[model samples]
Structures are given as structure tokens and as C-alpha cells.
Target chain A: MSEAPAVRLVEVHKAYRRGAQRVPVLAGITFDIAAGEFLALMGPSGSGKSTLLNLIAGIDQADSGDVIVAGENLARLPERLLADWRATHVGFIFQFYNLMPVLTAYENVQLPLLLTDLPRRERRAHVEHALSLVGLADRMSHYPNELSGGQQQRVAIARALITDPPLIVADEPTGDLDRESAADVLHMMQALNRELGKTIIMVTHDQRAADHAHSIMRLDKGVLWSNPDDAAAVQPAGQG
Target chain B: MRAVPLAYSLRNLWTRRLTTVLTAGGMALVVFVFAAVLMLDQGLKDTLVATGAVDNAVLIRRGSGTEIQSGIERAQIGIVEAQPQVALGAGGTALASREVVVLIGLAKRGAPDSVANVVVRGVGAVGLSLRPQLRITEGREFRPGSDEIIVAHNIRRRFEGADLGQTLSFGGRSWRIVGLFDAGGSGFDSEVWGDADQFMQAFRRNGYSALVVKLNDPEAFDAFLLGIESDPRLTVEAKREPVFYADQSQAMSTFLTVLGLALSIIFSVGAVIGAMITMYAAVAARVGEIGTLRALGFRAGGVLLAFLLESLLLSLVGAAVGLAAASLLQTYTVSTMNFQSFSELAFGFRLTTAIVLKTLAFSLVMGLAGGLLPALRAARMNIVEALRAA
Candidate 1:
């Protein structure tokens, strides 16, 4: 523990209710994701993979546990202050690559920095650099609808990294791309982790997508199994 | 408070042009009615105020609100004229005019039997000197103590027998319309002028309705008023001419304002409901975007402010359009009945700078009121559910 873990979840528990019946999604899940580690989470549907990612990203609160990220305990933070913390500490990439349809790629990449005190000219420079990192510099002015599915995901990646947060959590980053486009997106993400020293947590059902990460874990019935072999075995073949 | 870029709100409004236009159109109609009401009241006040002078004073019987309802007897007239504060003419005569105001039924030019009450004032010798604006635009002034009459342009144009060179028969006597005069297109343009003695003799009356006097030193008005009102021999009230004229229009103008305000309140209810519905639809349609914004670290307050800004923008567009439509009324001249005197009064539609500012402020209130709950709904959205919606 020379360098503290980027994310530490201690005995986190969460549940949902469907028509008066309580359904537990995560139960006492404990783990530490070291700084600069790129980890992939593998799980079946409804196995709390996405819920655990949300907890780490500060998008949702754990029912009862210490869900901490980047030295900040999100469980104790108010929603208002947690938003500021997330803006400075974590970047979120959704499964669908949720870029605002009305805003162009450049504007979308600049979204996170808008919450910061960065001057407009500095914001422009940061947006340009982030888009260039994602290989989307030429597509800066193109809106989401004008771009291909893979290009839109690249824009989403640029948006996630523009803040230069210590942690990036992506939920199914390439679940909807072609094999070649998925490879390109995964390579870009690996570059972000290796070159920039970013800690990444990815959730996916695709084995090839998970193979790009440095470490792997699986979630089953609200419990975490950290064996990389168990994670690899859960992945079905012929899937990206 | 940190705000979303105004462009975001502007672009959202542009994206849903149809709803924006429809909601803003309803607001425009409400603001139009509101502005027009204020203009109508302002126009009425202007017309009446223009007929009076700052240095002149009008005397009416105590407890009478207007000249039409007041009577100053022949004896009281001498007492009022003998006051030393009255200005003098070159002939050493006092600049005082004994006036009688009476309402008579007069037919319009086209419809002879459909009559409306018109104001006809009888003036003593110095009447023409006191009103510098009144001019004999067409013919000679009326000779005092004769059956001769001079008609104002509005009365001559709108009434049948009040025309030049015609005789108007009323009170069992016939009066010759000798001249047509103009009173600078003021409230007096709706009145007819004739000899006070002849008018009183024909109507079997001996008292003047009011006395109009010019003060030698305008600063001596208080002393003059005191001299006239405090006399034991006279039961009269005196007011500076402009003040008296403003008082005359107060009741009528207030009624117009109240009536317009009530209607605007009713229409604003509909406009507010329309704006609320439009905002609710905007929130419902952008559920995914809302969640995306939340995930991007935007606080709920930012989301709330963005929606409210959009609503405010919609209402402002409506306000501009409404004010533009109301401005067209400036070219129109309208007539309504004066409640105090029961006579037809004509005035034009008017607008002022203060009125424009007030109208815009009113629209902002409506925007804030209508957008509150819908914006709160958007801000309170659970991020997980919203992202899952689309």
C-alpha cells in the first residue's frame, strides 16, 4: 500500500424493491483497486456489476458501507458536495456513450471542465488536447448524430478524460461497436491507463474487451470473486 | 450561482420551436391586453390634462365634483370677480369668464335619431382671452348676449345640427352656429361654446355652472383661492386648472385600469398553465440528457436554473411581440362615455416608457411562476432511473 488505492469499498451493501419485494443487488462487497491499475469487472445480468461501478463513481450512494474513491468517502458526502467531488476526482463513461446530441464533439469534451474555474481559452486548449488524445481532433465540430457510433464513443472518452481525474469508470465501453472499432476504443483506453497513469474500472460481458485490462474480477449474487481465472472463465467465447 | 451557458437554453428553445412559439404566443396575447389597458388610461389622462392651464383656476360649488353638477349663482359671481388677485385685460376688465356646462342630446351626422350626450359650455365675455389655445379656425367668435354659437371641430364633425351656419334647437330656443373653433384638439374639442347669458336665459336659468379665472401673479393662487373659498357670502371650492382637470379623469381612468387588470389576471392564468405544460414536456423529453448532465457532475441547481432560463426566454419573446402589437394602437382614436359628466369623450391611444418597463417586469414574474415546479421536477430526477429511461 505504498500508494493508496484509487478506490476502496468496505463491506458495501445495496438493494432494490420491485413491487414490495426486496431484491439485494450488492451484499458486503469488499475490495481495493490500486492506483494506476486498469481493472475489468465481469458479471451476469442483474449481478450488481453496474451498481458497484455507480458506487465507486459517486453517481449513487451505497446503502451501508465505506465506498471511498480518491481519498473521499462518498457515502458520507451530501449529494451537492459529492457532485463537486466527482467533478474533480472521477470521470464516468456510460454504456451508451451519452453525449449531448445538440452539442458538438468539442463542446461535449469541454463539459467536465466547465465546472472548473478554467478560463475559456484554457478550456479550449484542454478540449483540443483531449479530443486529440482520442483521435477525434478532426471531428471536434461534428455533433453526435453526424458521427458514427465508434466516433461518438471516442467523443465520450475525450469527455471523460478532459477533467484529468485520477479515476475513470466505464460501464461497457465497447458493447455496441464493431470488432475493429471496439479494438480501437480499447487501445485508446489502454493508452490512457499506461501513458497517463490513470486508474480505470470497466464493466463488460465481452471477454476480448476485458482482456485489455491489467486485472479482472467477477460479481455473482452480490458477492465479489477476485480470481482472474474465475473472471476469464465467466466470459463466453466468440464475444468481443 | 454558476449558470449553464445561456446558449444551452437558447438552443433548447430553438430545438423545440413549435412549443416555444405556441406557449410564447399565449403570453404575447396576455401582455398585449395588459399594455393596451395602461395606454388607454394614460391617453384619457393626457386628453383631460391638456385642456387646463397651470396659472388658471376653476371655481365650482362646494360638494360638486364637476362643472356639470355645480352651480355658482349670479350674486356669488360678483363676489368672486371682485377679488384683487384676478388678472386684468388691457381694457381694465378682469380676466374672468362665467361658464355654464350642460349636457344635451345631439345626433351623429349619419344617424339623426341615435343620439348621445354632448357637452355644451356657455362662456362670458373674457372666455376667448383666457384660453389662448382656442382659435377661430373657420369663422368669427360668438358675440356675447346673442344666440350665436361656436362649435368645436369634434362636436361639429360628430353631431348633426352643431355644424357651421346651422341652428340647434334645444330648451325651446334656437341657437345659431356662427363659427367653428379648435381647442388644440384637447378635451374641449368634444364641447360646444356659446354665450352664457343667452344660454341661461333660454334655459330659464340664473346661475353659472362654474367660473374660470386667470391669476395676475400665478404665485398668488393660494391667496386667491383662500379669498374665494373663505368668503361667508360664497359656498364655492376653487382648484388650479390642471389639478382640477386631472381630478376629473381619475374615476374614469381608474375604472379602465381595474377592468384591464382583472382581464389580464384571468388570461395570465391560462398563459402560466400553457408555459408550465411546455416546460413539463421539455423535462420529460430530455430525461436522458438530464441524467447525463448529472453524471457529468452538474448539481441539481444548475439543471433547475437552465430550465428556468429557458422559460424566462420564452416569456420575454412573448413580451416583445405583445408590446409591438400594442404599439399599433397609437394611430387609433377611440371614444367612450365619461362617467362623471355622462358625455361622450374622445381620446387617442398612448404609450409611455415607464409602461414598457412595467410590462416586461410582469412577464418575468409569470415566467418564474410557471417554470418553478417543472424545473424542480427536472432537478429532483434520480440519475440512475433517468439514464435508464432511454
Candidate 2:
């Protein structure tokens, strides 16, 4: 694990336009996750956890302040460069698996590598290793619809790991999965962080899901708290 | 930037097989109409152009545009045939045919009540020799000054009282149909031939319609044409035989081309709209897929190209189908009134390589027009909003 943080947010702020209204999602957010840390963000609905994760992944821009990920300030990069930067630095996992229904498991995993200059034979080898790491080596030819939800998420994990990116951001990765499937996915994610020393940031509302990470942060009304009890102290009784 | 694979576009189109087929079918129908029109125009021009030999010169009245409207007196025919450039035949006679062209109304083979105008050509002794491609397909040639007529192969099958051994009552006289001659798909295949003197007397005509002269050297045509037009005693003009026949088809060919193209334009609009609708639907259905692709680091240009490629492939499939159907039209012959000659001319549809290239290019244009807007819409979608569509 490195002493320097893998991701740093310096007073980052973000907002969305709803007609003429400027609705702020995240305000004055500042945080850091060490190189080998597994941090989970817990928040209520509409609390900007996903927005913060998007900022760190370089998929969205900050309205003000800076978002630095993988030693580069993401807020300063242009959209074209940001996409390329994401391809090399950040892997994303969505709640719904987000696998292309038309492509098989191997092809879905091989999608990111297509952006690189990797040869076909080498791409096949990387895809094979990634799918095997997720324990779906035999299901490489199966499409998303043919696989169970847990299996599909495993395929997405293989896709995320195919490029061997430094940081992985998952937004409610196990939100749609059953208990057993969620446990399996969380265990896989933990192994990726511990064994490969990769930085991981997860956004989830479930405390049990957040428990898999090294530390947890709670967000409420565009503000962050290191302790869940500190955030709960400000909430009215029975409001959650 | 890495482009989406061609297989991806192909597979996506295959996934929506019904929409792809329906859209492509519309484009194919438009292509069929476009190609068929070109073939009809080519067929009309080819039939008339094949009627005359390039080495032969045709002499008609100075102001006449067609043989049917031309009048050349017997004295003028002799003066025109006596030119030094006229080719010599076997017995040292000038190779010229003083022909009388007249139109006669005859009943069609199946409908006796339906009468159509048919051309009757009275050729001199060397007329058959001049047209080397003319072959007596069924019987022998007509005897001179015997009221015996040789019906063209196309004329015999199309008109009544024009078959072999049949007698046609016209020109206040009975004429015997002695033979059926095929003119190798030339305009001559629509005319009946008899001796010039007998036709002149039977039709009460004082002069010939035109004089066809074979030149000794085809290269001497320019000087020969100059001499004939400059002659003070002659009221005739000379043109290369092939040029004369080709001019005969110009008006009718232009009419068919204009009409066919107008129809194709109207139909292509509908097909292009159909393709647009199909592509729009594809984009709407695949919004989530597009977002996922973007998230995987594909540029907007890649997404746009993929959709456009799918549309182009669909249109090409339609073009191939339409062209196959249009090619079959080559086997059947059609007859219509020639605007220039005012007589029914039979010609089959002719397909050429130029027409194939034109049709494919036209289909590609329709594809590009229909695919552009939808592809732009797909490419311009907001990534976060698009992912939420899933």
C-alpha cells in the first residue's frame, strides 16, 4: 500500500439544473482514500453518494473545487481526455450489471481492451484470465440473459478487471442481487482490493454491504461525516 | 479512435430482423423502379440504333426528321445514287435502295377490333443485301413485281393477316405474305418489306420516302454529306444511317426516361422515410446499449458510424433484391407507340452495367439521408441520462 492517497477531493461541489432551478447535490466535499483502501459511502436517497463516486471516476465534472484521481486532477481534464483517462485508471460496476445483452461473457469482458492497441490473441488471453478470476471461465460464451444476476455481475467484474485499472468504483453493485449473490460479489471485490492492492470506492445505502469495506462514510443533505453516529445525531427521530 | 466492429452493426440489424426486412424491402422497390426505367430507355435507343449500318448513308427530304415524313422523287433518288462515293455491288450497280415507307392500319393478332398503325417499307433489289443481318427465318424472300411481301418476324406475330401464307388486303390490292424475316432485333423487325415499284403503284405514291446508300469508304461520309447538301438540283439531306435511326429514338427515349425518373423520385422519398423511421426506432430501443458503450470508452463518432453502417447495409440488401427482380424484365418484350414515328415499336428491356452502378449509388444515397439524423441523435445523448434509460 502506498502512503499517498489514490483519490483526493478538495472542496468539490456539484449541482444539476432542474428547469430554472439549480439543485445542488454535493457541496464542499473533501476526502481521501489511501492506495490500498476499500472505502464505502453510505447515504440516503438523493444524498449525492453516486455523484461523488462519479466525480472520483472522472465520469462527471465538479461545479467548483478539484477532484484528483490517480495523481491527475480530473476536474481540469477535457471530456475526450477524461474518457481515455478513465479507460486506463478507473473501472466502473453498475447496479444492474450493465452487460451488453448481445455480447457473450468473454466479449463483454473484452470490451475495454478494444480501446487499447492489444492484439487479438493477447486480448483473448486477458479476457480469459479476467473471467477466470471471477470464477466464470466456463461461462465465457453465455450471454447476459442466459446467466443469473449474480453470474452477470461476476461478468461485469471481469469486464472491470480486464484492463487492470488502479481504481474501481461500484455504485450499488449488489443492490439488485439476492443475499447470497451480494455476499459473493462483495467477497470478490474485497479480494481484488486486498490481493491486488487496488483502491475501491463503493456507494451503497445498505449498512451490511458497506461493512465489507475498510471504512465507511455517511452523507446527508450534501454534507459528509466520518462516523455514522455523528450523522445520525443531526437527523430527527424516525425521519430515516 | 477505435470504431465499432462491422459485425456489431450486422448483428444488431439481424436482431431486429422484421424491421430490417421491411425497411430494406421499401428501398428495394424504389431501386427496382429506378433500374427498370433506365432499362426501358436503353432498350428503345438500342433497337433503333441497331436498325442501320454505320457505313451506310440515308437521304431524306431536307426538313424531314423521320423516314415516314420524308419524300424523295424518283429523279432525285437517281441523282443521289449516282454520287462518286456510292459503293459498287456485284454487277457494278450502285449499292443504293430507294425505299417507300408508308403506315397501314392493321388489326392486332388477339384483338381484331384493336387496330394499330404498322410500317410498310418498299425496298429495291439491293435492300436485303444492304442489311446483312436480316435473315429469312421461316421462308424464302419475296419475288420482285409479284405483289409478294415478306413480313418481319415481330410484325407477323403481332398483326393479323401478316403471318406466313396469309394475305393482307391493303392499298386497294391483295398482298401475299411470302416470308418471315428477323432483323436481329433492329427497328426493321417491325416493318413489312415488298418491291418498291409495286408498292408505289399500289399506294398511288409518285415518289420514294427515303434513299439508303452504302458508302465505298465510311471515312468519306463528311465529304459525301457536304456534296449532297450543296447540290443545287437536290432537295435532300444526308446522314449516317446509324445516326438517322438513333435520332429517330431520341424523342421517345427522353419521354420514357423523364417519366421513369419522376416516378422513382416520388417512390424514393417514401423509402427514405421508411428507413429513417426504422433507424429512429433502433436508436430509441438501444439507448441503454449506447450509454454502456460510451462508458466503456467508445467515442460519440464510433456510435454514430455504427448506426449509419447498419442503415447502409440494410439499403444494400434491398438493392440486390430489387436488381434481381429488374433483371428478369429483360426476358419479356414490350411494344408502345414511338412518339417520333407514330408507330408501335417492339423492344425488350436492356440492362447494362451503367444501370447497376446507378441503382446502387441511388440506394446508398437514400441510406445516408435516412440514417444521418438518427445517428446524430444517438451520438449527442447525455451519458448519465442515457444510462438511466436502462
Candidate 3:
């Protein structure tokens, strides 16, 4: 049996009022994401894909319409409640691998656990498990500066999974990685989606990385273009 | 919804080890100077204020500002003690003694003509019983009819022939220093004590510098002063012993207060500037990290609080350093001319816990004020811009 939808954006609109000009980024966009689904959003720069991801993660608010994620109406929530919702239900992985420079990889993984009611022993267990899953358990004590770009991104992914959030939003997670490291990272994401049955919504510009997702959707000029046949024909390379 | 503890702030401070140490050092220097001035003022005031005799009343000539300038006829000592409010000793004798004061020149070791002035007073036989805290640490008390003298402990090492068994020439007469005594570190420590009759004859002081009269009861001080003022025959003014000492310290006390305030103001400005520079750098360096925290469900308020705490910790370091440096000044001595006595007086610096605490509090205030603008700027930053910042 399939679970309910994890995220839904209904007729959502986002606009910026720049010196008397109303520039709408997302005009009446709508979508639904089922639980345990692997969906990829591919688009060029400034195509509103990242903005749509931010709205679903509750990191940004829409100008109008409903943004329901993890069963709550995110658009109707207050700022403080939205922050709490994001802390508990949504995990974010950014393109820059924004791990705190002062904290070690283990401490970076433990960041989201600080917002939980888990005991120290339990939090440590979760952090260790997440790092092992990303295959960085040996580098737990190393600071971000001591790690390479790919290693830093792995730490960021560990931080996201440590909280066990149902919906993970990754925005250009391999944008700064080399080709070999990027392929290794794509394999890890595919395994997380297929083996662990996690729900992931990734926004990227790379078609090769997009092929790993079960469904690939294109976004351009604030509109989504879906073609089921093209999405099925592309196969992701394993452990390349 | 992570609740930060004191450890969070402390750990953050430890993370920026270099910045923390430098800022704390600067604040410490400020507190040290501030504490030194306060302690010096307290020490000077304490030296004179602790010498009061609860049952004794001092008689100064009307309108005379200091004991050095106040004198009365030798015969009037009897009449002043005969007042009804006067206390008595054994054999029904009145509890009054005559005292004479003169400024003497002295020299410090390895220093030229330091030329500090001190009071040399003549006390009667009953004077020893009037002050119980006085103890002769060396030799014997001066003989009542002989040209011998006792020196206060503070004056013993401060001049030539001030110790016991030493002889000195004063007022054209040779006198022997027969004893050394300690008077609980009071105004009495600055004086030389001798036999009243012998002192009067040698100095040709047919008049006494002041009348030291013990009252029948301490509670009767106002009544005694009123009784003395009502009589035209006795042209003397009476005051409580503690009140008189405090009045004498007023000029120097005021000077020290102004000095302390001036130093604190100037040093606070420097401390505030130092704190501001450190906070600005901290905020500038942590742009993307701040954005991550903001995205991780922390409000702008939390980030602001964290930075402010960092600033406070830095300033506290400076305050601690300043206080420690100031504490070392406790062994230092300073000499200044007393406006009331018109003679140079030497006093030692003192550092107390209250002064240290006040300096630290001032440093914290400076830290808060200095860190405010930078912390607000960090809080007002756009999350997207901060994340995109290189």
C-alpha cells in the first residue's frame, strides 16, 4: 500500500516588487509528490525550480495559494511555526555544502539533532549511523577545511539524514564536484531512494544526474514540462 | 528550537581563540586602571577615618581648618574639661589632655629632601589609657618630665632618628626617641608623641595646639558641641572625631574621584572600539554559516544573541586582565600635598573585590554597546544573499 502525498503545491505564486515592477517567478504552479517517490526537477538558472523547492521546504513563503508539505498547510503557517516545521519535517542539502567551518564533520552531522528531544547518546548514535551511510564515518572528527569538496557534500548529506526527515530537498547537490566524485554521489542518492525508500526531490541542471530519479520533470519560465516516455528511456549508470 | 546554554557561548569563544584572548586582554587593562584608582581613594579615606575615638571630643579653635593651625591657651584645658558633659578618670580627674602639632621635615632613603610634613603632638600621662589600641612595639614610653619622645610605627622608618633609642633635634632642642608605637594605622600613625609639659617648655608653646576631651557619653556629642558653642568664654568649636577626620580627607578624596571617573571614560572608549572591531570581523567571516543556521530553523534573534554573547565574553577577558594588572599596584605608594594640612602626605594603593567587580561590570556594558550594531547587521542579512556570498 502506498502512503499519502508528502508535498503538494497548489496554484502557488511567487512575485518580487522591484521598484514598481511586479516580476512573478512562479505563476500558478501546481504539483503533488507521493511518499517514497524519487523526483528530479531539471531546469536552467532562474527557471524557478529552486524557488519551488524552497517553498516546499518551508524555507520561503509563496505570495499566494496553498503549499502543503508533510500534511500541514505551509502557506498558512506563521513564521515561527514554519521554522519549527522545517526543523522537524524537511531536511535541506545545498549546492555549496554549507557545513560550519568551525565544526568537525561529526559535529556538522549532529546539528539537526540539536533541535530534537533525543538524548545525547541517542543523538550520537544517529549521527554516527548517518555518517556511516554516507561512507564518511572515518572522517568524523575532521573539520570542513580538512575535507575535499566531495567529502564536504557527503557531510552535508549526513546532516540531512541525521534528522530522519521524510522529505529531503537537495538543490544542485553535486554542482561543485568533479566527474568521478559526482558519479559516486549519484550512486549514493540512487541507493538512498531505491534501498532505503526515502522521498527525495532534487533540483539540478545535469541530465545525467536527473536520469537516476524515477521521474524527471523540466521547468522553464515558471512552468513544468513532463514527458513520461523520455523520462523512462534514460538509464542511470551504476557505481560508475 | 535548540536551547543554547552558557556552554554554547563559552565554546564559541574558545573556537575563536585568538580573537577572544586579544579582546579580553584589552578589557582587562581598562578594568585594572579603573580598579587601581578606586582602591587608592578608599585606602586614603580609610587611613584617617579609622582613628576616631567614640568617647572623645576634639576642640579646634573657631574657624581654624586644621589641628596644625588651631591653638588654645594652656590654662583653658582645665576650663574645657570642667564642663558638665566631660567624662572623668580615676581620682575624679577630668578626661582631657593637651596636644601640640608641628610640621617636621623628613627624608626618604635614596630620595632627596622628600621633605614630607608630619605632626608632632604632646600627650599627657593619661593619654595612653585614652587609646587602648595603641601599643609600644619598641623601647619605653617617653618620661613625663624628660626631653624624650615616642614615634608612631609608620613614622619610625620614614625619617632619621625616628626609631627607638635614637636622638633628633627639633625646634632648636635635642630630644631622644625613646619608644616606637603602633596606633592601628590611623592619623595617629603620622604623629610624634611626647610629654606635654616637656614639649611645651622646649617648643615655647605656652598654648596647646588642640584640646582632646573625652565626653561623658558618646550620645552626648551634639549636646557637648552645643554647650561649648553657647559659652563665650570658651572660643572653641567641637566636632565628632569621625566627622572631623572625614572632613579632613574631603579635598584629596574629591581629587581621586574625579581622577577615577576620567580614566574610566577614556579607557572605556578604547575598549568599546576594540570590541566593535572584533565583532565586525566575526560577523563578516561567518556569512554563509549564518545563512545555514537561518535555514536550519533558527530565527535572526538566535544568531544575534550568539554574536552578542561572543562580544561579552571577549570584553570580560580584557576586564580580567586589567583587574589583575591593577591588583599588582597594591604595593605602590604615592605622595601628594594635603590641602587641609598643607603638607605632603604619602599613602599606599589598595585593591579590593568591590572595585574589581565594578570595573568588570563597566566592561560588560561596553561590550554590549559596542557589539550592538554589528550583531544587528548580521541579523538583517538576507538568507539567500548570505548563502550565495563567497
Candidate 4:
């Protein structure tokens, strides 16, 4: 059985403007992500992995080509509409957890839901549910500074899932955690993909963290290469 | 996102307490100066507003701004009294009197070496009875027919030799001060009263300075004014007491308004600059945090609005502090040169609701102005670069 891709990038190109210089970051990259699939993107520094993730997540614009995430062409959307699309359809997890230092873990989980028209009682229930999903219901009132690195990452994951977006894009989710903590986070991500049927696209340099994904895609010098048959395979050419 | 903004910004400010305090202090000083200027304007206006009494009308020479320069002929007094608009006294005579106003210098009591200006008025025998509001708060009223004088409550406290039985030399005549009186905190509270005939004879003045006419009805001011001005025979101007007092305050009031606006603008600019610097520092310190927010799907406009709200919140705190301190100034009397009266007039700080509201509103504007550019800079930051910095 096969599932349709949740995200499809067709010959996408991204460039940066630095004092009249159009320095290219990603050039003619193409990729697809299936629904409920766990995908890992492996790349060296400056290989455009983060840029590609930003483009797919609708956080940044692509200079050219179609970025269809959940069947919506993000590149053609205006900033306001793009923001609305992101709010409803995408969830992002950062390497540092990025929890607001002033807010408790529960409030951090509640952040994305504030953009919705949910009633206060309903929003609270959603946040509580998200926190419980991360196994952090007891630490809901704890601030980011008061929590450990692994706990903070859990809170971030909870925040990413708060809006129940169809797609979750995690940028080095385990980059700042210890080995055991990283394994715990990897387990949580696997559970989210398997049990909740969430389609996740994660970027990580650690092979051990990438080992949990069902598929591995590699980008080299702005180009993407992927395996056709193996459950998890990295193309040697792109890896280099 | 709405809840995140306030939560994040407030926590950030709390984390950076030292910087926030310094920024608040700078804004507070600016607001203090702004509030003081407004109070000065209000104080000057209130001082003159208090001078008008309901039953009185001030008759001056046509085209003159003050009683000091006004000259009404002695012959016109009979015709003015004969006008049906004049109120009748107990003896069936018109209740009107001629008076002279002049500025005099007196040595201040506490600052004995410093000279200050005081208004000395010459009134008819019926003048004391005309102003029934006047009361001798200390010492006796001056003997009506003598060269003795009665000093206003405020004048006696500020100047030397102004208490009962003390002597004051004015226009080559030394008069004894036998009374200390008050006239309900009006401009009359800043003057000294003496017999008009004796005062004019000693000062070598042939004509009265102005006439104080008690009208039959307060609303008859226009008719009385027309009767006095439109007649070719009498070259005089007549106005209701309240209207005349308002005009008399014009110069000082204008000065205060100009000073208040100038000070508020100057201070607000400084406050805006301080707020800008503070917000810029905040943006710089939170580069990574802001990037995280962007990466979490917050649009640039949301980030910009959040910072602007933070700045406005800080400025409002400062504004509240400044306004509270300024309100305490109601009892603080300051000696200033009244341009219209050409005297060192004493007025207390006046805190009006309108001025307070305007000052706070200006502070809010300052916050928005100062926060806009820095917030824009923060919003425009590249997500990748910010993440890399983190």
C-alpha cells in the first residue's frame, strides 16, 4: 500500500540578496513527503537543508518553482495568506526548543492555538492535552529555564503538535540533548508518527537520530537524492 | 500568538530588569518636566479666573487692555451712575465707584534683600462696602478716611512692613498698613487698598484709573457696554467682571501655553530617543528568541506589534509616576513674573484633568514612535541567521 505525499517540491530554487548579489542557496531541488511518513534530511553545513525545510514549511519564500505542502502552493501565496496557511497546516520544532522563557510549558503549548478562534476553555483543554501527550502534564507550570534540556525539547514538540497540523517539520530536534534524552525524544517522535499518524520531516546531522525515520533523503550542493526501495537509505552521491 | 506576545515580552522585560529600570527612569524625568509645564499653564489660568465676582463690571478707557493705563474722567462718573443699569444702594444712590491701580515694589519678608511687585489700589469710601466678599482675616480694616491701608492676605505674607501697623512708602507718601484682609483667593488677594482721594492727591494723579460699577443685573453687561462704548460723549469701555478678568490673564496664559508645549515637545523627543535605544537593545538581546518566534510561524507584523506594545507599557508606567508626583504640586507656590500685571505674582501648581490626560496620551505616542523602527528591524531579521546566532 502507498500513501500520497503530504509535501511536494518541484524544482524549487532559493536565493539570498546580499548588497545586489543574488547568492543561490538551493537550486532546482525536488522532493516529496508521504502522509504519515517519517522522513529525515541529512546534509553537510551550507548544503541548503534548513533553507529547504523553511521553504517547505512556508516560513521563507522560494525564488522559483512550486512548493506544494498538503496540496497548497505556498510559493504563490501572499505573506498574510501564507501565515494563515502555516497556522492551520504546519507545525515547526526548532533545535533549541525555543520556548518563551516567560511562559510555563503549558502556555508555550498554548501559543499556536491563540491564533485560532477557539474559546478560552477549549484552548485550555487543547493545551492540556498537548502537554499530556508529551508526558509533561506534571511540569506544565514549569518555565523553560526550570526544565532540563530533554524536558524543554518535549515542550517544544508539544507546541509543534498543539495546532494538530497535518505536517510537522523539526529542525535538529535532538541537536542539544544528551544521548539518553535524544533516544527518548526519538521514541516520542516514532510514537507520534506510528500512533497519531503524523507526517514528519526532520533535519538532523546525527545518524542515530536519523535511524528512527522510515526514509532518509540527502541534499548535496542544493540538489536532492533519495533511495527508491529501501525503507531508509541515503544516496552516497548526495551524502558526499 | 496573542497570548504568547504579552507573556514573552513581559518575561523578557522582567529578565532584563536593570535595562528596563534605566529606560523607565529616563522616560519618567521627561514626563515630570512635561507635567510641570502643564501645571504652570493651569495655575496661571486659575489665578486670573478667581478674580471675577458676579455683581461687578470693570469700566476702562476704550481700547485699553489694563486698568493701570485706563483713564475715566471724573465728570463721566455722574453720568455713568445715572444710567438705569447701575444698581441702587441703601441711600438711593448708584452703587458705582472709581479706583486707581498701580504696581509698587516691596521688600519680601523671608528674602528681605529681594524686591517684589505688589498691586496697590486707591478706592472710594464706598469701595470697602462694594466688595462685601473682602474680610479682615488678621488685624483691623484701615480707617476709611485716613491715609492708612489694608493689605491682601497674600501680599502681607510675602512682603515686609505689610502687617498691621507696619509702614509702606509709595509715590512719595508713607502710609501705615492697619489691616490684613482676603478676597476669596482672587487677584485682589495680591493687592493693597487705600482711600482713592488721598492716594491720588499723594501720587499727583488727576483722574481715576478705572471704575468698578455694580450692575442691576449681571446679564445687562452687553447693554451697559454698548451704552458706554457706542456713545460718542463717553470714551470708555465696559465689560462684565468675568470677561475683563479673562482678558487680563491672556498674556500670562499665552506664555504658559507656549512654555508647556515647548517643554512637552522637547522632553517627549528625549523620551522617544531613550525608548528607541532601550527597544533596540531589547531587539539585539533577543535576536535568537525572535528568530524562534518567526520559525514558530509568527509573522513579522506580530513580532513588531509585540515589541511596540512592550514599549508602550513601559512608557505608561513612567507617565503614571510623573503624573502622580505632579499632582502633589497643588500646594507648591512659585513666584513668577506676571507679564500682564508686570508684577511678581505668586501662583500654586494647578493639576487639571485635561492636562493629565494629554500628558499621558503624549507618552503613549512617544512609545509608539520610539518602538516602531527597532521593532521593524527585529521583524526583518533572517530566520537562518538568527538561528545560527543562537
Report the Cα lDDT for residue B89, model 4.
88
Top model number, DockQ: 1
- Calculate DockQ per candidate and list them: 0.61, 0.50, 0.40, 0.55
Residue B226 error, candidate 4, Å: 1.4
lDDT values for all models: 0.88, 0.89, 0.80, 0.83
- Per-model TM-score, in order, reads 0.94, 0.93, 0.86, 0.94
Cα lDDT of model 2 by residue, A1-240, tens digit = 547779888888889999999999988887777788888888899998988888888767899988888889988898788778888888889999888787889888998898999999999999999999999999999989999999999999989888999999999999999999999999999999999888999999888888898878778878886574532222211211
Docking class of 3: acceptable
Candidate achieving higher TM-score, 2 or 4? 4
Q: What's the TM for model 1?
A: 0.94
DockQ of 4: 0.55
Which window of 10 residues has the lowest lDDT sum in candidate 2 chain B?
A: B1-10
Give the lowest summed-lDDT range of ten residues in model 2 chain A.
Answer: A231-240
* Candidates sorted on DockQ, descending: 1, 4, 2, 3
Q: Across the candidates, what are chain A's individual TM-scores?
A: 0.94, 0.94, 0.93, 0.93
Cα lDDT tens digits, model 2, B224-302, are: 9888988899999899998999999999888999999999999999999999999999999989888878777888888
Between candidates 2 and 4, the one scoring higher on DockQ is 4
- Clash totals, every prediction: 0, 0, 10, 0
Model 3, position B47: C-alpha lDDT score: 68
lDDT of 3 by residue, B1-390 (tens): 454334445766788898888777777777777788888887788767766787888888888878889888856677788888888889998888777777777665446466677677888777777777678888988888889988887777676557678776777788898899987766677778888777777778768887887888999888888888888788788877777877888998899889888988898888788889988988898888777877777777777887888788787777777777877787876666678887656576777777777877888898898789888988778776687673
Q: Candidate 2 lDDT (Cα, whole model)? A: 0.89
Indicate whether candidate 3 or candidate 4 has the larger DockQ: 4
Fraction of native Cα contacts reproduced by each candidate = 0.52, 0.28, 0.43, 0.43
